[model samples]
Target: MNSGKSLKEFQEKLTTSRRIVALVGAGLSVSSGLPTFRGSQGLWKNFNMIDLATPDAFYIDPGLVWQFYSWRRYNALQARPNKGHVALAKLSELDGIEYITISQNVDGLQRRAGHNKDNLYEIHGSIFELRCTSFMCNFVAKDNFKHPLTPALQGTEQEYDVKSRKRSLHEEDASISPQFKPIKELSEEELPQCPVCKDGSLLRPGVVWFGEPLPLGPIDQVDNFIEDEDVDLVLVIGTSGTVYPANSYVDRIRAKGGSVAVFNTDIDQEILDGKVSKTWGFKGDAAVLLPLTLKPLIGEL
Candidate 1:
């Protein structure tokens, strides 16, 4: 079958599928002006984003970690949900069919797009949320969209020009080299403190870092959805399906005989040719393709 036929078949199946899930990733937010936490765009002042997203990094320099997250929060706040997010949000609201979105993105675009919270599971946690660092204190604040979360974080939300590979400081010169970029070492008191902690333990971004277990609540929810019934289809959007647990779901659903439809910028020609069994790959920006592909069910793209 050709790509056109595969898409038509996928759309036909989508209309009648009783159970559906969408696995979303960073690519979905790329069009919304959010950079993926990889590649040159992911670099922050001579630091790979992966290096800054670990517990050890936080342990060594909480202020630095907070600054990185504060920058992300600021960017996420500035970004609006794109068409892909809107389409998925609309799909979540459709009656009759059971649908869920398992998102690996921390940018919260899905929620900002008005996706149903009950059906959406943010596996990576949200940048807008904050939690107490102290294990003794179980304090978690949701929907804390306040940028420069604290006074210390003020003016720390510097934007990186990916094309030029330069840092654009709020009040400083935009042409500053990354090596000479002045590092602001904020004291613990300057960082955001947990209100619930008696001794004022520092609060961390609610995101799950490398080597940390995913939040049990969302994981359990996704697990239940997959185990409960036969999922008719899984719309794999934007993600390369690289990470564990989240990536594992695609295969798990496939094991239960679910069809897979991928919307991405880069896809194998064989998959697009419909040579892959029960799989269809549409190569393009998901923001553009998703709306068109889901238009049949949504009515009026």
Candidate 2:
């Protein structure tokens, strides 16, 4: 917990800051019952996320890849935006502040929370979007939230409770395995095909895969904001600040004399103790912390 004085200082800075950026990550969605897609918690049907989130995996087994993404799509849809997301959305709506939320999540929770589209940048492409696989075909369908995208993907969404001992026991029995295995070998004809392409090429999720480059448009927008404006404050919410490019923003903002307030469950002790200059770390569930911390901006404090 942050001291009242420290929190007041942060609130004062937030209120007076001219340009603000909220860099969001997977941690923000964890409160909404979404997985971070890391370590044991990220395992789906005993398959590693690294194996399923790559272009090579999709090339070798598009059906399996699609099935994995279909399951994720279903789960993302089922999750409601948490208070953390709502807080950022509300912040984006506030007048007289140049605010932008650069979210790495493709789950669409920020949008669902009513964040302004113009100010919200989905740096990583969204799962709800679909694009043709063929390089020559320029086909894209945005905001396609239809679950079980194809009939072949029906009932493919299986929830595995990694923490449940009983579920683990059931999964050990091969005979008792879910009836969705044989469907993994679905042929291209049974998968999502591009409507615009005459040859009917497969359509994959618009999300950026492990080896793929991020969408240029969002990247450019964020870059323009960073380059054009004198950033005054940056809210590092629910992220470890490990990944590149997005992680680099903290240093960039700090270099420009901007203050940083991190909202996460696991923040560094140095940051929490105010040992780091111009940074404040509030350790806790961001869903709970954000609403309390940003209350002043909403006239609640």
Candidate 3:
């Protein structure tokens, strides 16, 4: 955590940077009323997110998977972009600055924040988007926000203390409540299907699942941006920095003589320990930090 003169110096560096990139994660959306995918509150009833997010899970039980996604879509649609999202969007509007936001979040709040589609890369894909399960079908479309595709499958809403337990949103196993009721299974005919496929393949969530590769087109664009430009600064916002490729950007940018600054509620200790060169960690909510940090530079405070 750089402060006083060091902090001022970093701000000046940011104001003068020719190229800037923002690598955002789920934490950025927390203030927008969404839960982090890795937290205890992220659980849908007693369902483990990892179990529900995998291709195998979808293949085994498409109805249960769609039920989970449908709930996520409903929650996401209820959320609005937070100030951090708006501040980053404002950063992109700065004259003479080449900026791009590579987002790990699929909520699409960054796009809703007025970030240009051309300048934004949704690396994990978007919840508002859907694609055919049959990769060969190649059918994809923006979802019509039709949540609860099957009303019969919706779960009863209940509240639990998130602080009571910190469940793994990844692969770690956690106990499911004994009282949990399984999702009402819908037949294949009741599930959403690919509009273009004659064989009636079901549509799946547009997110990058546990073992799935990221969409190549966006990843290539991000790789090209880093390879071709001398990035002056990289802003890491609200991410755990655990996932690969997205997390790998920090090392790649640092290797190119770029500086990194992170605005996070939970700061990565490695950055504070000087594990990366020319790195600074600002510890706080990004909604507060981003506005205060970039406002003087971009007038969005």
Candidate 4:
């Protein structure tokens, strides 16, 4: 379909729908000047994402993980939200729309753009958070400001540039940027105590990482929301839909007879063959597609 025609139809459906759920991906943040995690632009050349994100890495050396995360926190803090983020946040304020944002991205841009806490879910863990090391500790709070730690995590210094990696995917020997540092080392002095149990360690960011279970509570809540009501449509933006549980949720919504609208540069052609019925896939640059596509709807709302 032509871009103009496709955008128009998607707009029509959106304006008429009352219950809309948006499954957000890292692509949504691309225009905001941040790279998608584990993506073509997100892969770490020197270190495996598995090593950097898993419990084993943190256990083997919290300094490494903390250092890696510290850089991420600093970078995310510096980045600004683009049009897509602002558009989604605007949707939340619309009078007739019941918009629930299900974002796969760990970046907190969506929240920073002012999407309501209750209306959105960050399925992956956020970079802006730090929970207590003690699982028993209930000291969960938003943390973006912390001092740099020693022996910080390294993901290859290449995390800063978006162009070099995309242009030379095969030949790049990117190293973790040297400037990044760790937010904390979990030392006795810096660690915050659990709010519920004073002796317990404070809870950290609640993001789901590789080799870990996606938070059951949020997943279950999403499931119940999709199943109990007649959801009008699903807006999947900026995700490759490569991850398992998060990827699988799209089909669950489809099985219940919901139509999907995808905005991504990497959508699989086979999935867009209408197996899910009336599914729409807009290719290339989510920052460009999502804002233009949703503007017509958001404007009318």
Candidate 2 matches the true fold with a TM-score of 0.92
Candidate 2, pairs of clashing residues: none
lDDT of 2: 0.88
In the range 62-98, model 3's lDDT, one tens digit per residue, is: 8878878877887888899988999988887777888
By lDDT: ranked, best first: 1, 2, 3, 4
Candidate 1 regions with alpha-carbon error over 4 angstroms: 160-181
Name the 10 consecutive residues with the lowest summed lDDT in model 4: 149-158
Candidate numbers sorted by TM-score from highest down? 1, 2, 3, 4
The whole-model lDDT of each prediction reads 0.88, 0.88, 0.82, 0.68
**Model 1, range 1-301, lDDT digits (tens) per residue?**
2357777898988988999999999999999999888877978776788999999999999988888888889999999999999999999999989999999999988998999999999989998889999979899998888877888788778754334544555646664554434458999999999998889899999999998999998899899999999999999999888679756999999888999998888788888777889898988899999998988899776
Show the colliding residue pairs in model 1: none
RMSD of each: 4.4, 3.8, 6.8, 6.3
Candidate 1 overall lDDT versus native = 0.88
Give stretches of model 4 more than 4 Å off: 39-45, 143-205, 270-276
Compute the lDDT of residue 208 as modeled in candidate 2. 91
Candidate 2 lDDT tens digits, 34-74: 98978568777778877898889889999999988898899
* Backbone clash count for every predicted candidate, in the order shown: 0, 0, 0, 20
Off by over 4 Å in 2: 159-183
